[model samples]
Target: MAPAPSADTLGTSAARARSAVLEEQIREDPGRFRMLTGDRPTGRLHLGHYFGTLHNRVRLQDLGVETYVIIADYQVLTDRDVADTLTEHVEELVLDYLAIGVDPERSTIFTHSAIPALNQLMLPFLSLVSVAELSRNPTVKDEIAHSRQSAVSGLMFTYPVHQAADILFCKGNLVPVGQDQLPHLEITRTIARRFNDRYGNGGTVFPEPDALLSRAPLLLGTDGTKMSKSRRNAVALAADADETARLLKAAKTDSERHITYDPAGRPEVSSLLLLAALCQNRTPEEVADDIGSAGAAALKKTVTEAVNEYLAPLRARRAEYAQDRAYLHRTLREGNERARAVAETTLAQVRTAMKNHY
Candidate 1:
């Protein structure tokens, strides 16, 4: 007899299946879907974020999906010691969202700190999940390892539960995620399932959200490793044209005179090719073919030009938005009010379902 498929394999298979159906449904009637996705306000937004998820958020919103973006300011405390600059980071995030075509009129953008009822749901969600299960979450483990801290905080351990609340508080039924993040969504789905099974009273209070996997390949940093702000390999979306060219000038690439698109064999060269391809909406191979025998200098120049041109309009918009801090604040204020109202409704339903509506 054949051995059973592993749990990870089963999960991946199930996610792909659900995603196919979700895509078809979205095509037919996008307004029927509500998407929940966001970022931690730890640092400035970068190219990795733009291509990976930000662009997708804009596309979905344009397609008529109900979009909600949370700044996740509270999540930064999981590993960091202070939030003194938290306010600045939140405003910068809002600017980045608006500059990238995330219209406030269409998509709701709010911060975790602004939604009390949303955080309140965490208490009950915590009860539905176990300590062992939380500890077993791979994404949580990866975060803890990368944190390089000697001791882990209880809040850090319960990070996934909070994420579940972030999604379920607004009754979100669709979440855009990468493959690595599926574990976090799985726990969220589990919480939704257990909560409904225990307190649903034969009627579901929360919908189990499915993962809308990102189609974009991971864009690495200039140093030929993962694109990260701390690593200083990432290109910030707010970087000026001169700074962008200067950074690309020093990018890592092999000494081969001829360029080729072999990510596994020539990651450094291939990474630059991928960047140009993404900017031009062409394939990496096509970019590589165009730069044949031009060597690393020409490749770097091509990438810099592509990146600077692509980001010019976004950076222009960001600069304009930055000049008006009052508008940014007002946007947040309005988003928070809208999010709170939604959370209040969801919490009220939870109270009714659990027979605690007194």
Candidate 2:
């Protein structure tokens, strides 16, 4: 529609585009954009895992918006208890983020356990948000259904409040989310407004966090189910060539002899093609056109190869970073310090707003 911003200036345009609301932001406050997003350090990241949300994080950081990656270790307890595996999972999660080129120096990457003030903010956040609100959170509902929880925990139910705290603690106004999480952020926005209505008289302590909906595709699992670790249908980012081949071979495809991209009718085949396209950074339609040039067997082989090659460097980097525990700890320590200071600033504002500083 507009003469596109040059490659140098495009980052400026793309950064704001992450949120539909953010698009209107540049017109109002061009330089005030901030982003927050992260994951529970529950398991290894897979191919279909966070790549969709993550690519946007990398690019947005390059575009000059403040970005934060919260390693939500405490959120892990809501669904299951991996008490023995907590330390390993947290460390691996950090390593995975590093291996994927999420530079901590540019972005603030910190663990939830490390920040006391932020956790303190969560208490006040929980007070303002009700049980009914928490119960209706799409993420919580999805998680509870997946956990098949007969009895849900207070922690699980309050995840959205913590999420609001995570963003509000950092004064982050923009969050990258998949379509499914839109409602969660809407909850966060409501809480921000409710908090402001109840709390803000001179000025709002919390920024009403907005959703930066990712343009990335929701990757389907190998069996055409959701690409989740629990389903055992995902391909881990750290998967080797042999593992990739095995998974690809085992992946469910259509009854037809050849491949096709009819998602409703041929979901399995379309999923495989989608995986291939994502690896090559192309589209399923483009891959389908090339299926004629390469044939079905060749398509599978090519797709598998493309995926393996794309992840090879990251896998290799993971091995290198894994060997250096001190390196990770050092970076994390620095990140924690930076994040703590930032959160403290927001908390100070919160205290002053509530007249609790005295």
Candidate 3:
């Protein structure tokens, strides 16, 4: 009968404790962790995607973490009116993922709509979360404003619950997310805990996932604003050598000319340096020092060369995969089967816990 807790307070204490536990976990055995992360199939992935999470995803797979990448196709419909080109968008996304080292053999890559069981889990998860709590979700609020949509859909409002289903369906115990998305993960943790406390038979039904913060620096767009597909500031992974060069060369830089690693005072120049440093696995300050007195033009050239060279191998692999449409389809088919298998297991457990497994 009492009011549900505010969104901000959902999992603050648990998240903090989970962070600590994960920190110690990595020290002991990182392979024991399972992670889930992905993006909406809006368009081809850009440099922002690469530096933000893709690179870390590849490393996590190499380190032997059980990783799952979800192409959130349903989430894309929250604002999009016409999905006539959604098929093309999903295909392009798969190509980008494969091109950027998201190995299907090493990690499971499945589309959200493809896993029906995952969606079914959402019905129960909804009951564990409240409308007041969902309404206060910070990520949902920011997304609505960013998309410039005046009306909210039921699916959009209950997005965090869907996300909870995604994580819990895979039994994902670790999620690599940005600081801004902490609240979403907090909601996921709260749902998992609430379900366990209410329905779990003398034990927890779901393991609350913890946040694995990325160390990559945020990359601003060419215009010094947030890099996004709609803004046309992103450099897609599928871009050719020439296209990549053109995008980088045209990126904004201040008139003062000389390059420095002052993010606060010179964000444009600093953004370029950050890209170059991340590409070459060096520090931004070190890259800045290496290009001392070289001016903005020189810095742009350095960054362009590094980015093109860095993507050369990936682009080649992408080209090959893009041509083999059958292979891409097969990859998805296999991933969906694997993902559904896991989802079924988890869903069965959930139904049993809630006394609906008769």
How many clashes in each structure? 0, 0, 0
Q: What TM-score does candidate 3 get on C-alpha atoms?
A: 0.92
lDDT of 3 by residue, 1-358 (tens): 9999865456554555666677677757877888899988888899998989888888878777888999899988887766787889889988988988888998998989989999999888888888889888889888777764667777888888888888989889999887778889888999999988888866988998888876667899988998898899988888887888888888999987567899999998999999999889898899999888878878988998889899999999999998999999999899989999999999888877788433
Q: Residue-wise lDDT of candidate 2 within 248-296, one digit each (tens)?
A: 8777766576556788897777877887888788888888877754555
Best candidate, lDDT:
1
- Which run of 10 residues does model 1 get worst, by summed lDDT? 349-358
Better of 1 and 2 by lDDT: 1
Please tell me which predicted candidate would have the highest TM-score against the true structure.
1
Q: Write the per-residue lDDT of candidate 1 for residues 71-124, one digit (tens) a residue.
A: 999999999888899998999899999999999998899999999999999999
Better of 2 and 3 by lDDT: 3
Per-candidate TM vs. native?
A: 0.96, 0.88, 0.92
Q: Cα lDDT of all candidates, in order?
A: 0.92, 0.79, 0.86
Model 3, position 246: C-alpha lDDT score: 89
A best-first ranking of the candidates according to their TM-score comes to 1, 3, 2
